[model samples]
Target: MRTGERRPTLADVAAEAGVSVALVSIVMREAPGASAATRQRVLEVARRLDYQPDSRARLLRSGESRLLGVVFSVRHPFHDDLLTGLYDAADKQGYELTLSAVTPRRDERTAIAGLLQDRCAALILLGPLAPTAELATLADRLPVVVMTRAVRHRAVDVVRTDDSRGLQLAVDHLVELGHRRIAHVDGARWVASADRRQGYRDAMRRHGLEEFVRIIPGGSGEEDGARAARLLLDDPPTAVAVFNDLAATGLLDVLRRHNLDVPGDISVVGYDDSSFSALAHIDLTTVAQDIDTMATLAVSRAVERVAGAQVVHRETVIAPRMVIRGTTGPPR
Candidate 1:
């Protein structure tokens, strides 16, 4: 509305529709009392007046809100996929998602605080790196579902793919291709990196490739992958399973630059089968998480908790599968 222009209210809509304020409210909220003719009339009059309901105020007055808060990292493309699934899942559960992103300069705490201020009914955190104590503390205040990471806290709900199983799948795929001297690039700085790293170790030992097992430290981005790839130059392994797709892309770039043909010289696999993995040029073989299932479960848990339903299981573990593509082959 323009400055000094009074915003149209239910009183205005009622006056225009030649109905009582109570009847207009009933029509607006789709309550049972309003007849079809009166409902249509009030809607038309409200539209003509460019009237918009203050849903927040209405929800607050009713002592309930259907808003579910989502906290996610801005840098991860996989988070984008989860978000798409989350929106659909929330809609199916009669709720809406409000987003708070964790950027390089913005912390998760700040994002969460904003959601709290908005009076969110529950919180869903994607790949949260918050301390166990802190997460537990948050759960005490409201329903909190932590996604993509397993937390030991009982109060908080967990919806995640088995990170260790994902890494094991990657290693198994490489070993089946006759790759013995397999190496793992670890994302130690990330939330589930430790689990993935341990999985790689367990798989390598199970294959009796213990002597050839190599662990390279990696970080969250493409450069970290590139850095790990550069470190392997002196004694490159027959195959490498990277932490995540973003870092794997960096590793691929470095390998290509050094004239090493992927799958021929060294087979590579990444985690998170992200959006870029299927690109024509970057067809990376990687581990895929069921984003739809995870998102749906997260939303369900949040909604159930908000509705005071009995939560049988606090942690929901989903499986991961390996997507075979051009980046992986029998190492020659």
Candidate 2:
């Protein structure tokens, strides 16, 4: 044996872990294949030896960056959750997720091109506002995944809540509580916005309360909610269902200012059972998105494509469940 030589490689770690070299590779690349027990063993041995995979060397050998580009809306709670889930899933599969914040002013094409310049193998856009055609065009160039948004393009994959159904769940709950006149705080510009609006109208008509439907223009944020509440100050409805919990907080604040009791004089419902919705102070009645399933599926789809597996252009619409909390009650 030579007196001096280079340190051990994945082959060494695999031998030490009693696993295959390919399994060790999967652990480093974050790709799918190995079982959880094998992955843990390989990772433990790699850690004990302070083994660092030469990413540059690996990329050169594999002709893949093994990098996933993630663009999320800044400072958004839902986006934050999506990012956390994306990261966890990507890490488990041995994939590196490189993140960028999509500033409102930047167009989708420009943001995506920047990610491409960084050599990302794929892109995941959180709540994108791009037209379906543009998204389809992007799919032609690379594998792309859209989260919290809908796309009908056969080339791209979408993961989002069934917004129409989520809205119906909100309306039916409010109507069951003897609420005849129920107003809705609308979602902003996007696929979700339009579908949710229709759902609210449909549910109202289904209950034979079409005359009671009122639409208030508001985005999915606390400020928008506050503004919506102020708009209804003069003639507040018996109940209100907001677009999301962020806006619901604003509505609650404004309601408190006007000396109106929630669920007493003006019951309120919110969407997206985000962390804030469950807060002791907020306790908002809201619709819950299946975060774990959405995250897992998004990652799995992306990884499948990256692993040279063909994925059909499709969208996964997970159902939303209504969560009853302190903010809603019988109409007074």
Q: Write the per-residue lDDT of candidate 2 for residues 1-332, one digit (tens) a residue.
A: 13475677888898899988888998898999989988888889998877888874677477768888888876468788777788888888788888877666866667777888777888888888778888888877788898888887778888899989999999999989899999999977744888889899999999999888899999977899999999999999999988888888999999999999997999999887887778888999998888878888888888787777877647899999999999999986
For 145-170, candidate 1 gives per-residue lDDT tens digits of: 99999998889999999999999999
User: What are the lDDT figures for the candidates, one per model?
Assistant: 0.93, 0.86
Model 2, residue pairs in steric clash: 29-94, 30-93, 30-94, 30-95, 31-93
Candidate 2 overall lDDT versus native: 0.86
> What CA RMSD would candidate 2 show?
7.1
Q: Count the clashes in each prediction.
A: 0, 5
Pairs of colliding residues, candidate 1: none
